[model samples]
Target chain A: MKKDVPYFDKVHRWGRIWTLLALVALFSVPLVFSLAHDAWPEPGPFLKGLVAILPLYWVSGIIETFTYTPMIGAGGTYLSFVTGNIANLKLPCAIAALEKADVKGTSDEGEVISTIAIASSAITTTVIIAAGVLLFSIPVQWLTKSPVFAPAFQQIFPAMFGALMASYLRKHWKTAAATVLIGCIVVFFSPSIGIGILIVVTIVAAVLTSFLFYKISTKKSAAK
Target chain B: MDFKSNWLMYLLAAGVIGFVVVESLFFLVKAWKRGKELGISKQTLVNTVTNSAIYSVAPAISILATVFVLANALGNVLPWIRLSVIGNLQYETVAATSILSELGGSLTEEVTDPAKFAAVAWGMTIGCCLPLILVPIFCKKIHKKVGDVVNKSSSASALADVVAAAAFIGIIAAFVSKSINGIEVTKTLTGENVVSSRAGFLSIATLIVSIVVYLLLDTLATKKHLVKFSNFVMPIAMFTGMGAAVLMTQLLPQSLVLWSWPWLPPVQ
Candidate 1:
């Protein structure tokens, strides 16, 4: 926030402070609940539960940070991860905004677009969800759970990625083909593949294939 | 009703959820102001906000539906807190279910023990906190290094774009393959493992239908020049695909698909 500080530097400074606050806020819910009700977790059950879930989610957390941080930019990464729904809502929405603007995601213009779009998505979702809980809980609950709507809820991922994948594949088939092929091979071996591992493997494959394709296309052009 | 639904529980959830709201607003304002200073038109920035909001409507509604399901065990406030923060339906459900099981509690049953309830909340909390912690420490460094590498040459810059697109393709590919292959990820030692899978022909049908409708919408927007209507294309295509799901469930029979898992019914 200092006048001499650059915008990018300022973002990191404030982002660290806010992120630390958010982390504390995240843990406070249960801590306060225990204090208010005089209810404490029995150490054995708590450790058992923690042991089962922590390693996998944490490893993916590590993977998600590395993979998505570069793509979404610093500001986008800070906001989107906190607001959650990175893959489904935040990442796709930011990429789509960048696509619409015809800017590269690595550009400064791309950072502004991604941050604005992700922040908007986060606020909009929070408002809608808050409204649902406070004002329209009954109708919202019934409507979403109704037979007519249940299938839609369960199948949201396929519904979302169908178009998104098509749009990306159309423009970047050279890289897309490589990644998708690798992803399928992995899936064939393990039908229910861990998303973090899948992303890591396919991304590595993509880098190699794209380099190969890039070299070939350039060589052909030079010869011509 | 259990202790999870008490008035104090709602207050605690609101406090945490409120923090997220404030965090979002703080970033939204900062970005909006930065966009203006960068000489990006106000109209363009406004369009981004509105268009992004329109895209969010479907996903938010679907998320609320998941909240209702989670509410059965942990009550309304806890699900609201978890979902509004860094957790999703699948992750939250699995975390809470396993934690309850450790305490000899059932997620399908109303939790009466305050200690067990507190444990579930703690479990969900610790599982998702890594992102928030890791981001603050590492995000600035990662962003800058990646940007610096990309700027080294025109070819490097171009490769950056391909790499980003490839990341998206990598994720979507896993999802598409899951639908085509019959794979259901129940929580396991690693938080996700495939215990059962059905012949997921029904999901394949939905995926195809969605792709077709989206293409049609793209045609309408680009070929027909429906500029104003373009904003609704993604959401419209999404809902239409949902309609396909309903139709497929009603008309498509389990017997019709080869290797179909007999238990993978249309709905829970």
Candidate 2:
């Protein structure tokens, strides 16, 4: 079957429009606040604040854009970037959906499934957070204070990733093993390594290793 | 005007969150229709939606907890709005605290001054907004490059799959390692050594349980030919792992304290 070139092009067009508008809308919050309160941030402290986080977050953001965009596909990329929480929520959800549907990220079916999954996850997260905020008194208190539930909340990342890793490894054991070995070495030896930097390095290493392995195996098969 | 926890601030927050919801709904409808046109069954699409929704709850609640922490520092509405939009728990907390400390104020205290509050709101908004702008500008280019490489031949397409799998596995491994290895030791006032990494241990335990649960469920689903069960397995494994973590915490020794990241919301 031929690719849906026009459909993807349309998605990119609409994605650009929505995200640019989102950028404007997001900045407007602080702008409107300053105007309404008749108060602008002091130049010194504001610059100081920006300088502190700008370097790290900017680099991380740039790295993430390159690393995640291809994996998430066109529609999923657009929506996940806007809604945020890429690593924690949207990425995992999208990957699980793709895996369940048995679709490759490079395929048209993969693109559609990823988009649907990410959109649904974003909507669900927004509604849940909104409800949690609006009904904060009892829910927040219980969530934070209930001793029985505290560990569950604390261990959330591990639990979510564990399930995801199992499924992923079952399909791609060689790549998963190599990645985990590198990850373990970095994490164990230098505990202070930043998570963002760790992710970038591991990805580079995994891709290089996988490509080499694929080349050698293909060469052997051809020789045979 | 009082800037701390004002009704006007809440109204502003509500407006931003409303825009996000509308935008998400627009994309959701578009994607759903596209999937239908592509011959994906309605049941599959609905299952994706349901699965994603269920998968989102635990993480959403975690984000909500961070909102409560930020509410204590920056007031209710700003954190509410910040988190509802492009902000995550770790980045916002770190940004707010860093900005607050720069101004000689702490995030543990409320920001009553409008100027300081604006500084924080702007600092967070701008610092995190880079990706939103960059993604739109460069996502198409990146996608095009990937598509070109993958479309070359069958071998190239398989290589691209390997690359994607590698990236995902590498990222997941980093996270898992961090959870397991993020340990610390501190001395008490009485000079007793306290191994303060119960949280890490709990997470390790959770990871084990989740993996086991997922494998068992996956096997059962395959045997029974239950496609829906496969779709729902992630959330189920997560919940089971979380339940096990809770049990471990209750039964674990007191000397081993469960330490959260410094930026995480404090247990109140």
Q: Who wins the TM-score comparison?
A: 2
Chain A TM-score of prediction number 1: 0.90
Query: Residue B67 of model 1: what lDDT?
Result: 81
| The 10-residue segment with the lowest total lDDT in model 2 chain B | B184-193
For residue A74, model 1's alpha carbon misses the true position, in angstroms, by 1.0
The residue ranges of model 2 lying beyond 4 angstroms of the native Cα positions read: A1-5, B183-200, B252-268
| Candidate 2 lDDT over residue span A162-204, tens digit each | 9988898787778777777777677666665666778787888
lDDT of 1 by residue, A1-224 (tens): 64688888988887888888888888889999999889999999889988988987798889888888877867888888888998779987887777766677777777888988998899889888888877888998787677766666666667777767666666777777667667666767776566667767876787777777778888999999
Model 1: per-residue lDDT, tens digit, B75-177?
Answer: 7889998998888977887788778888987777788888998999999999999988889888988988987889899888877777676666666666666
Can you give the DockQ of every candidate in the order shown? Answer: 0.64, 0.65
Docking class of 1: medium
Classified by CAPRI criteria, candidate 2 counts as: medium
Model 1 interface RMSD, in angstroms? 2.1
lDDT values, one for every candidate = 0.77, 0.80
The digit string of per-residue lDDT tens for model 2 on B1-268 reads: 5576677777777778878878878877887888888898998888888988899988888888877776776766787788777787667876877777777787767777888888888898989999998988899998999999999998788888888877777778777766766533333222233443423446677888998999999999999999877888889998998888888788878545454444322332
